[model samples]
Target chain A: MVRLRLHLVAGIVLAFAVRGPAFAADFTVPPVPTHYVTDNAGALSSATQTSVDAELKAYEKATGHQVIVWIGDTTGAVPLETWTGDTAHQWHVGRRGKDDGAILFLFMHDHKVRIEVGYGLEGSLTDADSSRIIRDDIVPRMKANDPNGAVSSGVAAMLTTITPSYAGVTPPPAAENVAPPIVSGAVISMFGLFGVFMLFIAFVIVMRIIGSIRYGYLVMRKGAPAAKKEMKGFAFWDSSGGGSSSSGGSDFSSSSDDDFSSGGGDFGGGGASGSW
Target chain B: MQQRSWIGPVAVIGIVVVIALFVGSAYNSLVTLGQAVDAQWGQVENVYQRRADLIPNLVATVKGAANFESSTYEAVAKARASVGQISPAVVQNAVNNPQDFAKYAAAQDQLGSALSRLLAVVENYPQLKATENFQTLQAQLEGTENRIAFERRKYNDVAQAFNTRRDTIPTVFFAGLFGSKFNEKPYFKAQAGAEQAPAVNFSP
Candidate 1:
């Protein structure tokens, strides 16, 4: 019984120590792009792409509104717009802080069309307007098996409804860089830090043992103050490494100019979703 | 004999030190999580309060319009009253006590649904919708609704972390070993009927 309990305890520790990552890293939601139009479902042909792209570019150029479209086979189990909202946060779509991005999500296999309006756009493009666009403009084309016509006409109708805002002078070119994750090196280097730390701890323990053995006789004889000098000596010798590391850390990171990447956009989950 | 003589004291000291480290870390983590709950509760409260503050202005604006439904006005007032009715103690302890959180959430959700109904009613009065004050207030309310949703989502995430740390086996086992009183917290669930899309019965 004791052995069984011990084995169970060990097994539990082992399980926790080796427990894999919490969530599946499903790459279904791909990274966001600079230009509009991601037709993953192959729903749009070249001609359809050209027209849609032209409209989106013109829309962005005229006003800073970022209206992108996603064509996919399915939105999984969740309602089409909820998935789109989650993806919107990840993609950081629309102008930062302004929340002027809109996505026309088309799940081809699922036969769902959702118009996700960002918070900034919610004023001009109300739920009623989105629903009307779906009902009058997109659904008819979709039912007739014309995906391109549905998106094209749907885009055109949406453009008519959207109120334009000044995008300011569009002087700067869009910067595109695919950088690795921030903590990419930290995980690997952590093991080295841990090993050094553990070694230091072990050294402290050994030193304590040696000190007790050597100074125990002296401590008892002279009553505890005799080893003070020896401890201070050890402390002074060890602190320099810690001081150097922390001092090095005090200076800012070398590439401080562009450390963080984001457009400062926020999502409030105000959008209209629908299914055909 | 000499080495063996030191073994007991050394082992005891080493064990005590290791336990202190683990228990210290565990306690610190619990403290951090507790503070996180408090911080998020404040955030949720702030947004909820903003929504509450807008009610009087909205009510006044709605009242100015002629022949608006009194029942809708009554519902909004009652919902707002219920939200105010919940004791602050219950809301503060909401993280630990699911029942209290449920009651609080229900009241708040009641206010939310009533506000929705009220907004729907406002749609009938074209002149009211066109008013600058009414329009601005509508925009603010919509924004606040989104904020409350975001904050609630954040609170759930933090509470989940706390609960996971408290409930998971090895941590649970250690917490028991050390006699730590870490316990599971609750999530803020969406109000009933919130999942369904708002009725599209109204023709554009």
Candidate 2:
């Protein structure tokens, strides 16, 4: 019975240790691009890409917001929202705390489009606004075989919606729907504590043995009367022992100057997805 | 010998202080994670409420369509009512209580299926689908659904962190010291077949 219990405890420890990596392995989001406009699918013309990139750079300078256009081949079997939200979060597209970033993702082969608005930007660029942009600006132009017009005008509409204090943004009062900013730092720090936890477990087991030995000595000397209180405390510790430590932390330092990098923005899956 | 006597007591006191400090830090970390779990629960509720808030407008819009299926819209209204019937107190304390959390999730999932069914039924109504208002509502609904999924995933992530921290050995000792103040948070299991959204092709 004792051996079985030990095995069970070890199993729980292994389960917790193995859980984190299992989650990260499912969908691999690509690294954040150094450029504001990353046209992996070559969906946009060079002129359109350069103009959009310059406009986004200037906009970020003016209002600390980050908007990027990414054109990809596919997101594989992963759902569009899951992939986009994860990418936006992993990229940390907007300023830390402000979370005012938006990404316009166009998957060429998949024929899917999404305007993933950051939590802060969701207020200014509502889901309806994003949908309309895809419908009126992107979808029609894509249907007409004008990818450049589709991206340029769609970006222009987004900027116009959010610029000058999010003026002209309207309807649905989705303030209730927007997700709060996430604390990715907590996740990183949590991983470091795994090794600390392992040391703690070893200490606890040693302490437990010492506690029992002392209790046995007291019982033999005083017929188990006075040490009962101390024994109860040891039992409490015994009950709480199971489960393992955390591990594997990645450094997420955002570099400065000429290279384009995310300002640590957060997305709450608050934008629209459409396909043509 | 007198000086040597002080060494034993001093060494013991030093060890006691070190242990106290470790225990204190563990207690603090548990408290932080517990609070985070609560905050994430609030976000889940907020997004769920957003979906609930959209139901009335959606049902009304669908109701206007000629020869629309009354059964589909009625099921949505009924599911919405069931969702509303779950008391606020239960929702507030859901993290600490798995049964309540499961009940809450079930109600929300019921409403989800009902809403999806209604949308599927609307494919027959091309005229209703053409209206600008309906399209906007559809967009908002899609956004709201995505938000629900995103927020739920986040809640799970934080809850996992809290549970992991709470269950680990030394912290487990501190967690037990706090009584039920740090109950292991319940996680949302992906419902079979319901994890994927029903395909609603918007292409003309």
Say which candidate scores most in TM-score.
Answer: 2
Residue range with the least summed lDDT across 10 consecutive positions in model 1 chain A: A241-250
After best superposition, candidate 2 residue A14: deviation in angstroms? 7.2
Clashes of each: 0, 1
In terms of docking quality, model 2 is incorrect
List iRMS (one decimal) for every candidate: 8.0, 3.7
Give fnat of each prediction, in order: 0.05, 0.40
Question: Across residues B1-204, which tens digit of lDDT does each residue of candidate 1 receive?
Answer: 777998999999999999889878876787688778778788888779988998998999899999889899789999999888888887877776778888898899899999899999887998887776775666557546755765676676676666556545445545444432454566677656443334332222
- Model 2 per-residue lDDT tens digits across residues B1-204: 778978998999999999999998988898899899899899989989999999999999998889899999999999999989989998999999999999999999999988988888888899999999999889889888888887887788888787777766667655655666887788887765443434435578
Instruction: Give the per-prediction TM-score of chain B.
Output: 0.87, 0.93
- Model 1, residue pairs in steric clash: none
Weakest ten-residue segment in model 2 chain A by summed lDDT: A244-253
